[model samples]
Target chain A: MSDGARERILAKVRAALADVPRGEEPEDVVVTRGYVRAHTGGELIGLLVDRLTDYRAVVHRVPAAEVAEAVAQALKRRGVRRIVVPPDLPTRWTAASSVVAVADEALAVAELDGVDGVVTGCALAVAETGTIVLDAGVAQGRRAISLVPDYHLCVVRADQVVGDVPDAVALLDPGRPLTWISGPSATSDIELDRVEGVHGPRTLEVVIAE
Target chain B: MSGTFVGMPAFPEAASAATQNAQLRHNLRKATHTIRGKRAAVVSELDDWAELRAAGKAIKDRTLRHLDVYLEQLEEAVTAAGGHVHWAADAAEANAIVTRLVRATGETEVVKVKSMATQEIELNEALAEAGITAYETDLAELIVQLGEDRPSHILVPAIHRNRAEIREIFNRTMAEWGVPAPANLSDEPRALAEAARVHLRDKFLNAKVAVSGANFAVAETGTLVVLESEGNGRMCLTLPETLISVVGIEKLVPTWQDLEVFMQLLPRSSTGERMNPYTSTWTGSTPGDGPGDFHLVLLDNGRTDVLADEVGRQSLRCIRCSACLNICPVYERAGGHAYGSVYPGPIGAILTPQLRGTSSELDASLPYASSLCGACYEVCPVAIDIPEVLVHLRGKVVEGKGTTVERVAMGAAGWVLGDEKRLGLAQRAAGKARGLVPKRHLPGPGAAWTDTRDIPDIPEESFRDWWAGRGRGQQR
Candidate 1:
């Protein structure tokens, strides 16, 4: 965080690059393309939809004004009675949900696990390849909130969706804790067969609030 | 250097055992496919990924080209930052350095962040052999260690186990290590994670020594970087009194600016995130903050040998993002164990043969593990042409043999095809004998090729005969 520390880190980076042989010059990563037609928030939501679907995740979309209603509806659909909300998530996001709201503050492992779904916002979304990135900050809770729950409902806005990887990288601060999710957690064993929901969320729902 | 898996049969033999294990195959397929899909989606998000990949490859290749210079610079930087740098030419020397360092701390136990270098050197096994216990702090790694299994995936080492299986391993084996698993552990993912957390908490709190592998070592300031998804890496990196890092010499990038490229490339490629959840960086020993004593062991086991070859040297560019492993079709099937090394999948195929040399049967067989599909290349964050290396290594294997049957057969064919008159005679004779040529190949050494493939029958007439009958062979 200090200026001196930043400078020292940069100095080391320059030294590391000194001897790197210059070859075919690298091309700049471009982030703009009009492949999928959606608004910025719509595009972000679409990426979450496509990627989660590819990863076999369930997706939901809601209007910006009715986000709380959507969350409540989603929980009811999944038969979830209690939900974990990060300490910093907007109060309005869960207003419509009659389910018990559990704050993520020093809660015991048993208590956290009792909750069904956790709702949070992502740090960034990349469109070129549909991915949702989370940094352990205010809107996005601690690492465990998204990780521990079996069902995860993440909110993403259109402006947060970047067109490509470079654009997404530019938006991230290296000092923060970041989590990138394309879809729900899944794995492929030796035979190239797929299995979903191993470590992270088994049922991932992205609520793209346009 | 004789680790647990040493004396293991060649890849084909090991693969035969792995391929038949349906459970293992299922687990591997599920893990690799999920990660591969995430990696693909994240990677495609970047239009300049090709450029970034090239840049990553260029940086590593450039670092390896003048490795001696960069290594010296790194040592100087580390020393200036209050850390001691020890160079180890081989695994034995490296292990000795680490063991001595830990022993100096007078600690019998050490907590560890997952590191491939340590695994490659069998450092934990060696330390255990030395009567010092090393606790794996990473969740997946802990599952593997407790279960007494080798890691099957690079990023997620416990990709071979399902949740239920992991719960079983934890419940069955946690007490023997340190803390005991909860009396009633459920297969629920959260409960399983809690069990591991409760089990590992004591190790973190009490550890006197910590061992780590660095993702990037900056030469300018002598800082070491470890990026992880879990907070366990942060705990191990910060809590210990003495910290020891066993890093490959190739892990260095001369400056933090260079690190920016890898930082961008690694997280996106490995976990499909824009950044890792935990990116811990330390410069030497930070007084009153983290580890008081820091020792850096620079390892160069067979890396220089790999660097000697112009084509193979590019392997040093790998960032160990595991993107190649996730996407590799062969890796998805045969799994990591078949590679017979800590590093597995496409990177393992090329790196193992080069590092260990093709002298051993396992090392020799590794180069042929891939189907040369080029998928690994397509997904590589550093753009390693794995197929090219595999083909190149295959050539090396052929050249290594003094007189293989294929060589003998090819030699005889060369003699027959050497002269125009001899070629004409052979073709005429073959034409006369066309009906006798079998539809399928005859049984013998060549049978392996025909067993799974249809052998092409010889043409009814030689092109020369057809040309001669058309009245143009001799005149032309």
Candidate 2:
């Protein structure tokens, strides 16, 4: 059955293109890819911080040595009791926080949903669009861990921030499951009015570690 | 709507009522203008928008040109990634394949993302007949489903409904659908979204089967990309155990590099955002992350027929962004229901006739729905020359099977105007009968035209007669 439908569709397509010249190929089409890759000149980290804040995501900027303190303060402000983290995340980042850190491995979805928030590192962040790329890499757990909870607190190092979408795409591996998140979940469906916090995390806190 | 689009009235007949609806007109005007302003602001931020638009058009064109080759490549990649691929020639086959797939999993209920491809096939209605329920998870689609209404716009299906109307729908219908609304829910967008979140949480957690449509399918990598603002799509894509995606054959891009161009073009042209909140990409059945069983159904309902026509083939490049709908003057006044298809607005005018053929009154009248304005062309990300295709389809309608009263009248006019003496005699006859003509209304075949327009009074003397008497004296 599959072969029959497949052959018929391909045959119809072949018959439709009978008028084209034999020598013409898909590569013959000249598509100029001259669009700018990165718009920010040199203030990518600053732009990333600014754009994320514009999305109503809480932004924390601090030196590398103060990363733990920043996470602790963000968790304290939200009054989160328990947080989920990927196993590979640096132990020191959550060492200062008072909340219990639960590893994502073998945790049921219902258990993850019970947690107040999830904190982990990102694959990279785009400055112009204010998006974090998660490939289920070392510190980033499966897509569900970051999605199910009510709050998400992500950490982005200064070196992992890119200036634009193309640069971010170049750095990530597509073979792995990838999720690009710009801000907390939002919906503009109601008469085209944007309302944040639908199904995913309602509150997003980003810490830019220099 | 007569429940569905079948046997619907012509465009002018349907639009007459919609134009008189001041509330709908006001709602559409406000919503479209807001989005239009936002789209323009974000689009101008990119310095090379024109180049990006050009690349988007070129990539789609090249992909369509070599579709057979790329489709085979896509099928191989998807199968190699442990996802099953199915081929469907038309809507019926596609629906049957999906229904059977759902039954194979022994599940009666499935959660759905807002997919136009499934809506085109009326899959939910089909599943209803088979004793299965399909829950619409998108906030807009949920409004449409609960209200029992047709989707008027592509992006926001409930564009015609205001906050008050949505609040009433939720209060009246939410309890019947599994979760009830909060007591005395306020008419605010945030409160309504939260109500939906509470109502759909259990369904998402318990759903074993999920179905969707994709924005772009990377042929080389077998990855399907779905970009959405709300996280409902992520829930439907990730939480379920079995994922079935029904996509049109034209959604393929040759490579991930080709996908980069569309990733930039789509979000800005669509929600007028720098980037949407959520973008999910999965190659196939990921062992532990997303759904373990993935099925990709490629649909080809009348697409090959569209591709055969050289002039009509460009309509296939549409990315369903609804930018044309937001920018259209006719759409703002007449609204989207008049088009009578899953696709609507200016793209609908050209695309519906090509996909469904100009057989029904609604389909035949779509090409003439537009004012031949080029605003849709200017904003189209894929650069579909919509006005050009509309004119081309108009010609096809006139030359095809059925004959209309207007065609006969045009034929008579052509015959008389072919010769100078016949034209002069006809003009003189009309001149003599000028007083008998009605100024406001015509009696017979011209009533449809004159119902909404005025008829010009005929002059006492023909222009030929006035010129003929003066020319001989000047020659002497």
Best by DockQ: 2
Compose the digit string of candidate 2's lDDT tens values, residues B326-358.
999999999989898888899999888999998
Docking class of 1: incorrect
Off by over 4 Å in 1: A1-210, B1-3, B400-405, B463-476
lDDT of 1 at B327: 82
Cα lDDT tens digits for candidate 2, A1-210: 345888888999889877767888888877888888877697888898888887888898999999999999999999999999998899999999989999988687789888999998999999999999999998998988898998999999999998888887777766788899999999999889888999988888999999
Best by lDDT, which number? Answer: 2
> lDDT of each model, Cα atoms only?
0.74, 0.90
TM-score (chain B only), all candidates: 0.93, 0.92
TM-scores for chain A over all candidates: 0.76, 0.96
- Candidates in order, TM-scores: namely 0.72, 0.94
**Candidate 2 displacement at residue B456 in angstroms:** 4.1
What is the lDDT, from 0 to 100, of the residue B238 in candidate 1? 63
